[model samples]
Target chain A: MRSSLLRAAHAPTELGMKIAFVTPRYGEEVMGGAEGAARSLAEHLVADLGHEVEIYTTCAIDHLTWADVLSPGVSQLHGVTVRRFTSAAGRDPKFSDLDARIRVAPSSRSIEDSVAWVAANGPVSESLVEALGDCDADVVAFYPYLFYMSVHGITRVRQPAVLHPAAHDEPSLYLPIFQRVFDSADAICFHTEAERSLVEPVLHTAATDQIVLGLGTGQASGSGRDGAAILGIAGRPYLVSVGRVDEQKGSTMLYEYFVEYKKRHPGPLALALVGPVSRPLPEHPDVVAAGIVNEADKWDIVAGAEVAISPSAMESFSLVVLEAWVARRAVMVNAVCGPTMEHIKASGGGLSFEGYLSFEVTLERLLGDAALREHMGEQGARYVASRYDWPVLIRRYEAFLESVVARGRRSEVKR
Target chain B: MGVDGFDLDQVRREIAAEVLARRTSGSVDAVEERRLQRLFEQYSPHAGGVGALSDALRSVDATIFIDPDVPVASSQPAGAAIKKTVRKANYWYMRWVTTQVTKALSNIAGVLHQVGSELDRINRRLDLVSNDTPAVIQLADADAWWHNRASEAVARAKGRVLVAACGDGSFVATLTALGHDAYGTDPRAEVVPTHGDSLDLRREGVIEHLDAVADAMLAGVVLTGVTEAMLPAQRTWLLRALDRVLAADGIVVLHLLKPEFLSGEARPVALELAGVEPLRPSTWVSVLHDRGFGVNLVDGGPDALIIASRGPRAN
Candidate 1:
């Protein structure tokens, strides 16, 4: 009996799903944005919908012991039940070699090694299946990529399963395994429309009915209604670009334009680029890279600016633009990416630029005219509030899970 | 000891000053407070308040007693005679001494020795309660010792429950082999393992009475050495955890380097704080007994190992 079959045999109805989140490591404070997001999502699922949630993860640096490797078992954490799977990564030399190989090329013997390692030292998929067999869940949602080996074992089980694909960057690298996973899953979820497009080729045309869950935006409050004079800008107040230092983020281009625009206009127009610069910038002072900032710091930066600028050519969804809108700051975006264009058209929040000169002019006009910035900022905030918020987004997620569970039940009935 | 170097008269004067200072203050803060507290709590006072004060003063007087420019007392009797004569002369001069000088000298020596002995006991008690043996073993000079030990231990005790005391969940990966019920506790923060589950022992007051908790449980207890010497509170909590959760019939394993032999260029700050003290076998036995645990000495040499069980109660 395969683990998935056993899991399916014991899986509950759609209304009674009890989801167990399995990860090699679990904790909100730990590394990796994906892990943090997963932890946050789990918390929301349990707190709001009364769904049972559990996270399994590794320990931090200080408290490791030998017994952890020897006796793999389940323990409770912050209302979640976590089961640790032991591996020989730290013990056997072969295991270390295998882990290294997997890092270089995930399709190599590393995948086999990981599967074998979990089967031998850590808990097998059977154990998870048996554990779930004891519980009553309508479906199991698997966060894939690193834990890909466990996916096939999970999908083959008795219950329905949903794959919440948190895809980022070029999707081609993972197309092979992702295609298999997509076919196996009863339903799929995408973080952005751009991400959804990336997987469109591999996904069947009929699967368009599958959930295209968009990345939700955060809350927005306070408007820059006091105008540009109170904001302390001397000349034509301009735009601000905020993001981490990455080549794709287009900080260099934003800087070049700012320099040119400053040369053209004598007024106190400033393009404040906040967030850390991972790469070196040319000697340009007006292009202020404020480095990494907290929420309060970002609010102050946005509140004083006439408009928010996003020059990223490949953003799945711009968290910075959402933040700017929340602060009631007018936005300027490059004509790239689906989310940015959709947001601009829907909210009439601000303007978009096809080239550098036009972007500079738009920024100058917004800074010179305080009334225009105010009007755009107010409209942007309203659009963001209605669409985002976890309360609204999570309902969509729940409905997607329900649909997956329902499809699985109907398929079983047909069989 | 020579009379000139070990002057009983001068010592006696110092003792008298200390006693007078303590009496006037109405508290024991004038002396080593921890040592004084232990003494008063442990020993039955033979003398009444005033007599105890006088005896204490007399003891100080006798410690400094010396012959005029003499190197050594001729014999034990002669040294005794000299001490008595000096105290007697002082008593006569003071005109308020009631006890015989010879008896007073004996009483003073006895009290000082008693307090010193009590301090030794407290130090030993502290060591037994807080020593993080498993952490010490994992950190032993051998590389990957934690991983190996965890695997081996789990393989050995497959069906039994394993309790990792004062462990952060890092060892959860290693202990995953044991198929046993594994739980961890740390007073500082809840260490939720990425691979396994961990209960926050702080909420259960496990940190406060770790020894009792460890002793009461029917599971094997593994203490991960988390710089026990640096953290006094963790040591206390671990000791209590071991005492409470460790099964009576179960083995309590610890891995620690003899404090004197700890390698890696010694940290001046840690040394100043932790201090260097040789771990003695007898010290281990005595300390464990004090914490309601019986000792079964295991591997030793430069690095020490011990397996202790809940010992017969003192009462």
Candidate 2:
């Protein structure tokens, strides 16, 4: 009883070095790349570096609907303390109206409209913002800047704000309200330098301390044999596209382009679209939509394909491209997607397409030369091995976090 | 290989040339870039003149007249015939009414434009009277006899130290070289990092810098340049700012010119414009004592370095 009373009086010392993450939605099953990246980072920081980790998130399971599926309260998930808050709103119709106006002319919108739009967008949990005020962690990290959790949590907390802005070149990034979000961050974390280059000048935060940390890719798995069989197709030359097969991911365009390519070539070349199909796919004899394959199967399909393609024009970081490289496969990317284009340009393991013509030309070249495909795949695999090995990434992350904590935002005193 | 070492630029160039060579038609659509507006900043009138708003107003004034001869055609054949007949019959009256309306509108626009010009003139004259900006000074001595002593005391201090009016940020550099977390604020923009520097230096006046800082945040503050020509009112404001922002255990290092030297012939031309010179070390001692600080003085040729510690500092 005496020991329990003592523990109650001095609680912080019991929980070693404390750190908290404020992500919009978090779970191993969560499909959003940024959310999953945050979860992976939190788990690794706890298991590898021995930092006490806490995840503050909403009860929403699906991002688009933001439906509160899980019960709100504290629980343990994968050895980390998880606090789930109920969202104040679900789907706000006004958000669409405001978003449409901002989309037409994003940079000129008033800061008031930007604030209203951010609040209008769902997953607004008042309890989460309140809890951030009471938190006594060494640092609070708010991931993926578009959500309401980051917009409110970073300003409410007294500790240093580390913003993991999984940002892309989108209209919402130009909103005036994001200036405050960028300025409030004691240190900004970016997934790619390309993302940094796009966001840094929005609020003149070039002098702000920052780190570019890409998510770690898993080890190579599965052989290239049963991938074609799993798709219910006979062995033939096929190109695979990974990630959410939705209109936003450029799936519709890929479909149209692939059909046209097959029409011109007049062969048994096929296209296999992978990952969760958010939108319905049109039926075609040459096209296969195998949605949400397991990790091993995903790698198997990547290994089996002639060229792994990411057709999306908007991406902050393309982890799928790196994964394909790990599986020793050549990839194709959209030229305008800054993050994926950065990856392809850096790796020399992929080709980029502007439109149908370039796509046709690059595809024909890669398909015609097997030796060229092998060389590109090997080059990409080597690049991934040298740059994104897990152990080195973790060490660099841990060291950077320690330095930030030690530095104490003392420079902010001169502001 | 590191991705940085990859020769992708050469390949990208090759692809660009190839795509351009194969362009047989203008079928490839032009990608329209989205229009963007810069962040809004409020316009303030200065001594120079008015901004783009005045130009826009002039443009509107020049185009306010009604064109009266707008075509009377309609898309429908029957409607077009009827509208044309009516417009011909009423053309004389329409021209007379439009001429009067245009005259009134044009006159209003011209008057509005004239009022804007008058306001611009008044604002420029007001600016001349209100602006009493300070000149940047390079008077702080980086190699004073007490440089090591001041740096040692600050290096052993507990929290962050600020060097106010740190010309060229030399004192800040000295403190940082000794591993003390130090930053400086100078009135001169050239003294900041853009002038071949890498230190933490902000371009702001001493009081402007302290106003942004949270209360009780600094463990130490080293002051220079700003002390020599401050008015009595500014000195009081400075003391209040210092008392608020400095921690209870904080120390202050002031590099001031000797009263005798300030009164000498070699004193700066800038100081001659000031109505009041700086206080002596003894006067600062009495003034700082009332604010609960203990003061000590160190001699450096023609200057006095006042080291004031709040109550009793641990270091």
Model 2 misses residue A63 by how many Å? Answer: 1.7
Model 2 TM-score, 2 decimals: 0.62
Residue-level error in angstroms, candidate 2, position A5: 13
Segments in model 2 whose C-alpha atoms lie over 4 Å from true places: A1-16, A223-225, A409-415, B1-14, B25-315
Q: List, residue by residue over B250-280, the lDDT tens digit for candidate 1.
A: 4455555556555456423444445434345
Error of 2 at A348 (Å): 1.6
lDDT (Cα, tens digit) per residue for candidate 2, span B26-72: 33432200000000000111101112446446345444556556576
Runs with alpha carbons beyond 4 Å of true place in candidate 1: A1-17, A20-40, A56-138, A142-159, A166-174, A192-194, A220-239, A263-284, A409-415, B1-315
- All candidates: DockQ: 0.00, 0.04
Q: State which candidate has the highest DockQ.
A: 2
Query: Residue A152 of candidate 2: its Cα lDDT?
Result: 75
lDDT of 1 by residue, A1-415 (tens): 1134534664433233456554444553332234445565666666667666654443321111212332357666565556654433322335545433443333333335545533332322344444544443556666533343234444454567555555443312232344445555554555554555544433331122245445455453334343233233434454677775545466665666567567766656666667756575766545556666555556666776767888765555576777788888888876544567667777767666544445544665667667767777877888778766678777767666654554452221110
Chain A TM-score, candidate 1? 0.65
Q: What docking tier does model 1 reach? A: incorrect
> Given the true complex, what DockQ would model 1 score?
0.00
The global Cα lDDT (0 to 1) of model 2 is: 0.73
